[model samples]
Target chain A: EADIYQTPRYLVIGTGKKITLECSQTMGHDKMYWYQQDPGMELHLIHYSYGVNSTEKGDLSSESTVSRIRTEHFPLTLESARPSHTSQYLCASSGTYNEQFFGPGTRLTVL
Target chain B: GESVGLHLPTLSVQEGDNSIINCAYSNSASDYFIWYKQESGKGPQFIIDIRSNMDKRQGQRVTVLLNKTVKHLSLQIAATQPGDSAVYFCAESRGFQKLVFGTGTRLLVSP
Candidate 1:
């Protein structure tokens, strides 16, 4: 099994609430990424990090922000969540050009 | 932004049969391609990958075929089983960096 993990597998919160989704991996991978996806839709990369203190936005526009202070931890936070942000968030990690290992994912629902 | 598959195409196959799922990508600079499998309410897990220099690679009962000439990729699963039911995705990478993922195909293996 993959070592990657995501917290709050399912979440339902009211509008304008603050939320943080946690992602961590014990594989010691340098590349970490966060993607947002809806049911039966294409995944959109939202954020990625090369290493600690390095984070970049992906091709898609996102309201969530991420921090990579530790190699094993990359967390995403939405200061003010909205209904538009409802989707499944996936965390992935990779080494070199090897395949990416994904977490179980966090399903977020905004009301 | 590059376009991944928008709709999730589905394939139903009988147990013990072989299944093939195809994907077409637009990026010509993509040098690496990978296949991922995702179960319901979970993140995508890597299945196999092939570099642009190679046309095919095998992993256990799974095979990945990359056709750079047509910018198309395909995945074949031999001896399909009910446990193989899940969504499969194709991802392309340029220069071994950022990845562009296809919308994905759902496979259902009947017993």
Candidate 2:
């Protein structure tokens, strides 16, 4: 089984509030990614990291920021949450191998 | 603009029947393709994958077909069961970098 985990499986907050989503993996992967997905919709790449201290923006523009402090941790932060930002955030990690393993996901709701 | 997409938004199949999900990608240079299954309120799980050089690959009751000439890919599940209900996604990658995920397809298996 994949050893990836995400904290706060679900979150609800008011608009303009700051929030952070945590992601970690025990598989010692070098590549980590964060994606935004709406209900039954396409997954939009928000942020990704190659390894510690390396981060890059994905194809879709997102207001959230992510940091890769250690090989096993990648966290995403939203400075000011909005109703539009409410969606499912999925964290994934992949090694040099072909497939990626995903976390259970965090459902964020900004009222 | 350039991305991977699913042809069907949803597919329903009776139990013990065979189901097929199709996907189209615009990047001809993509050398690897993967299929993923996502249950409700969870992130995607890797199902199977196929390389550009291969036209077909199978895992258990699942099969993946890759057609580079048409830039199309497909996933087939045999003896479908209720547990197979979920959203399916196809992703394409080149040079082993970030993967471009297709619009999801919801598979609803009926008993």
Best DockQ among the predictions, by candidate number: 1
Position B111, candidate 1: lDDT: 94
lDDT of each: 0.90, 0.90
Worst 10 residues of 2 chain B by lDDT: B1-10
Residue-wise lDDT of candidate 2 within A11-109, one digit each (tens)?
Answer: 999999999999999998999999988777788888999989999999879899999889999999999999888888999999996578899999998
In model 1, how large is the Cα lDDT of residue B7?
69
Score candidate 2 by DockQ. 0.43
Clashing pairs in 1: B5-B103
Q: For all candidates, what are the clash counts?
A: 1, 0
DockQ of each: 0.50, 0.43
TM-score of chain B of 2: 0.91
Give the Cα RMSD of candidate 1.
2.9
Docking verdict class for candidate 1: medium
Clashes of 1: 1
